[model samples]
Target: MELKWTDTLDIAIELDEAHPDVDPQYIRFTDLHRWVTELEGFNDDPERSNEKILEAIQMTWIEEKD
Candidate 1:
């Protein structure tokens, strides 16, 4: 399934799986933005994302990690 900016939880899951060695708690928004756009099945416009969206994704990723 194609991923969108609204797919925070799913995106978090993908990130967790894709970067198993990375710590989501320490990731910067800039790198997070790049990673999300590069993810497989991600099809949302990168420009549509804001700080809030990135925060949600990061929070979900942290949850996934734990």
Candidate 2:
């Protein structure tokens, strides 16, 4: 089945969010695009790193699960 992104979750699951001490710096669009292309085989993929992007933006809901 083809994968399609929906706004079911506020934070996208495909992205990788980063939380650091310094001010948050989102991943470059080029890098993100490449990663998405490699993973999903799409160059203009938005979901790519979006969840992480959201996490980088606001990491609150995610819990520390082991």
TM-score leader? 1
TM-score each candidate. Answer: 0.97, 0.30
- The residue ranges of model 2 lying beyond 4 angstroms of the native Cα positions read 4-11, 17-25, 40-66
- Extract clashing residue pairs from model 2: 15-49, 15-50, 15-51, 15-52, 16-52, 17-52
Inter-residue clash pairs, candidate 1: none
In TM-score terms, candidate 1 sits at: 0.97
Tens digit per residue, CA lDDT, model 2, 10-66: 222333322222222444546534433444423334644465444442232233110
The per-residue C-alpha lDDT of model 1 at residue 57 equals 99
- Candidate models: Cα lDDT each: 0.97, 0.35
Candidate with top lDDT is: 1
